[model samples]
Target: MLVQMFDLLATRRDFFVGLLLEHVQISLVSIAIAIVVGGIAGILISEFQRAAKPTLAVVNFLYTIPSISMLGFLIPFSGVGDATAVIALTIYALLPMVRATHTGITNVDPSILEAARGMGGTRMQTLLRVRLPLALPVIMSGIRNMVVMTIALAGIASFIGAGGLGVAIYRGITTNNAAMTMAGSLLIAVLALVVDFVLGFVEKRMGMRSKAAKRTNRRLAVGALVACGVAAACAVVPGMVAGAPATINVATKPMTEQYIMGNMLKDLIEQDTNLKVKVTQGVGSGTSNIEPAMESGDFDLYPEYTGTGWAMVLKKGGTYSEDEFGQLKAGYRKKGLGWVGMYGFGNTYGIAVRSDVAKRYGIKTYSDLAKVTDRLKLGAEADFFERADGYDALCKAYGMRFGSTMQLDIGLKYDALEQGSVDALIIFTTDGKLSHANATVLKDDKGFFPSYECGNVVRTKVLEQHPELRAVLKKLDGTITESDMARMNYQVEEKGEDPEDVAREYLRAKGLLK
Candidate 1:
């Protein structure tokens, strides 16, 4: 697994390098911002004893909000990118820094403070020279805690389309590529360790009272500041490396199949044109998030489902005509978006059961499973429980209720089923694990599912800005069949191939690329 992970890293060196720098950039910026805000807040609260409790309470409350939820709340104002990521991480880094600053300052000995004052020191001098230096160790400890936490939480930033190492981790999970996941995780762990060790060493050295030690600490602080400046430059430089090239940003929902499609489109566009294609994969909140970003011009294109665009985006329910494509295009036109073309796959949601359970219950269709639902336990992703076309509506459509339901991570659903923790699951039509787990997909016999034909959807303004984009994207129209998509997903999830590699091979095999 380690060898495979290294091999994967070597093959995608440029991409991984960008992600690494991005991760560092997000962490550093967030920590710097937190230090400024948290450090000041800590000082004020420490000095004003009456205000300490309530102020600390507010900071604590902010920290207690779930990471993803906090990020979601920030997206409306910040959109999807490094700014949003930095803001969210900065908030998360605050509590530790604030607490540490307050603790360190308050713990200073009273006699030492009085001595500084008696020596003609003003209140400010007493704080800067006496209390602050004495409190240096504790304050440094808080900064250390904030730095480590920020690095780890920066991974979650990728979910909101802020480029970072988390992109690799989430992609690995969606595709069931253990090597990819491991590679990302290991790198993040190493980064956190390095940051902690370096800061910790500095903190210890600063705690020494010797005059020579103070000189050494000042030199180290200068060196650290320089290092931070360089890191900030590295984080922002890569985004501009291509030098004003006509760029198209692609967005993708958080799933294996979406990864394959998004990368495929990115590869095709980059291979054929001078235009730079920046793909932001595994965007959370699905279409709800992606659509708004498009409207705000944050993304140029993404693979969107017809059913999602129709029912969810257009708010037109109970659909279908053979002419659905025309209707979808017309609807999106009003929103400054265009349906580029279909990729020739219909990836609707499905109810699936373990083969043994399928056989025992004679469950071959959704309705058949409904009869035995009271005896079955369902496991699905958290998103499935909340989607408009998700669990609640599905149950209503089939008139079925499971004995119990478990909301498992998308990557773990198959494991849950195989382990008999869940008798059935919500599954994507193209998930590779369906075969690995020996599961049988139940037919949606009553057509409870709307048509979910996959296609490229781009912002119309982006197409107008770069006329060749429409031509570049034409290469993918009707290229991948339904089975082809499933096989591509299988190769990633079950065979542990990278999605980019899988997409490249499929395009070559189809003679779309040499």
Candidate 2:
């Protein structure tokens, strides 16, 4: 395992390096902005005691909101990526920064201020020269806390398609690669500790009694601030900076197969064209997030399902025309999008019963499973329960009456069944777990679930901008089969193989990648 991890590091050195730098850039910028804005607000509140309660209340409330939830809320307005991430991180950093600055300033010696006034120092001079310096230690403590917290919390930024080590973490989690997840988490923790140590050193230096040491500390602090300014500038725009390669943003759902697909698109685009591809894999709500991002021009394209668009995106009814897929394409075109490269796979939904349960109950099909559901429990992800073609509808259609339904995370459903927490669970056709499941997938004899043909949904503008992409993407059409996807997913999820490697191998096998 360690050998594999080392190989992963050696092979993906540049990838990890880029993500680490991005993580640093985001954390630095968020801390810097939070300190400035939060410090100002803190001073204002300290000056006007009446505002303190409400101001702190608001900051505290924002701090309490989950970072993922905050990013989701900000997406419609700020869109996705680092901009949204920085904003959310800054908001969270505000509470510690504001409270610390306020407490430090308010706790300063009253006699000292009176002395400054006696010396004819103006109010501003007294606050800056006397109060601020005296409050430095406490404020530095706050800054340290704020900085570390922001750095740690910054990982969630990847959920909204922002770049960072969070990509590694999210990718690892999705593919069940503990080594990759640990590597990403270890780096984040180390970054936080290192930043905290630097701030602590600066704080200690400021407290030095010697004038020479004070001068040295001032120089060091100024140099650090200058470096921070440069990093912040880079973080503010990331790939949008002048001279950077033209970027195409592709998004992916939070699943193993989608992660692999996102990487495949990135590899293909970069290899075959002058453009750089930035894949934002693991967007929280899949189509819900990526569709809006695509329409708003935030995302250039993403892998999507035909049936999902049929029912959810277009809100079409159960009944459809013979050219239903044609209608699906037309619907997306109306929204300024185009479908390309049907990957020749149908990762549709399925029912998998614990092997023991299936054998004991003679459940070879959906109807057979339904007969015994009265004594068994059903399990599926939360979204599976709420989707248009989801739990309630599936149960109603098949006349299933499970003793109870357990809402599990998509990743945990297999484990839930293995642990006897559920007798049957919803499973994706391409799910890696299916390869090794101690469960039997029941045949959908009723043909209740809609077909979910997989393909790329690209923005019309992006296609026009890079006409060559149309041909490059054609290489993927009619390539991957459902079994092929399931096998690749298993490679990543159970074998701990890197998704990029697995994707590359598949594309290489098909002569699409070299």
Candidate 3:
């Protein structure tokens, strides 16, 4: 484990540093936001004795809501990424700081406050000199608490594509890699400890030094003004640039069949047509990313599963046939989206076991696996834990429970399964490892998983303006099959080949490109 840690640190130094940086950035921003908002809230609560109890109760209640759910609630407004994470962390950081601020400011010696007022200090002057100075040590304690809470919450924020050390931790937990998990946890712990220690020292020194107080206040005032000015400028500038290169933006989840298809389409369209293309990888699983990006006009085109589109994007509540093209077309139309074209293959979900394990257990079908369920171990992606038709449904259907199980991210499932750490895994049928490692996918006799046909879910406007994109993509629609997709995924994911080069080579070999 030590060797693995050193190796990961050496090889992934940049990634670890980036994670640590994001960790600090999120924590600092959250603490700052909390201090501003919570301090004001504390002040308001302090002024009115009658309102104090209710206000504290509300802020305290907010602290009880799970951080991940809070993030999900903010997803619609903020969308995914750093903005959502920062906002969530700020809210989480508010409770402790608010309580501490209210306690600190209100608890200042009433006699001192009276003396300041008698000395001709105005209300603001009294606040700045007597109340604030006396409250500094306690407020610093609150700030310290906020910092720790924000650091912890930062990891959960990675679920919404907010990159941080949490990504590594989530990947480790899902993939069942103890080394990676410990690495992420250790790094976060170290960061939090270092920050807390440094801040504590600063607080102790500030308590002793009367001369440093005024200078610190001046610096803070200037910093706040500069930040406000920068924010005002950013608000005036539009998020999207006009007359920029006309490009199609594709969003997709990591290590899925749709991700591969999205990459392929980007290459095909850019090479064959006079259009620019960019792909945002790992946007989140299912239709989590599709609707928001399309509605916000952040993305132009991306691949989505037929069933996911039918249920999530369309808001239709029922299952559809595997080859229900008409239903899919109608659904997309109703949702104000366009289906550019469909891939020939359906990336179905299946339970895969190592070939040796399959033989040992006589597990040929989904039912067969149930016989030896008590002796086997199962692994699934992180999202699978909450998915409607995922682990919960699969286990219920099979009437089986395992001796040990782990929730892994989709990206790391293959590696964990291949290493024999997990006996059975929830995997996509088109996963590269099914063929690469000779894994056996048990037959689902009950047909639990619906067909996940790969296709471009393009914004209606993009399709109308660039009708040629539809035609370009349609040319290669049925050319790639399940096996072909698996191989291509392996080429990029396993063999370390660039996805764009893999797509180009596939297109060239198929005579689709000159």
Top lDDT: which candidate number? Answer: 2
True lDDT of residue 240, candidate 3: 57
- Model 1: what TM-score? 0.94
Per-residue C-alpha lDDT of model 2 across residues 313-375, encoded as one tens digit per residue? 898868333368988999999999999989999888899999999889899999998888899
Worst 10 residues of 2 by lDDT: 315-324
Clashing pairs in 2: none
What does candidate 3 score in Cα RMSD to the true structure?
5.1
Tens digit of lDDT per residue, candidate 1, span 111-191?
Answer: 888888889999888888888888888888888878988998889988888888998998887777777788888889899
State model 3's lDDT. 0.75
Reference-based TM-score, model 3: 0.75
lDDT ranking, high to low: 2, 1, 3
Model 2, which residues run further than 4 Å from truth?
A: 1-7, 229-244, 319-322, 371-375, 401-407
TM-score of each: 0.94, 0.93, 0.75
Give the better candidate number (1 or 2) by lDDT: 2
Compare the candidates by TM-score and give the number of the best one: 1
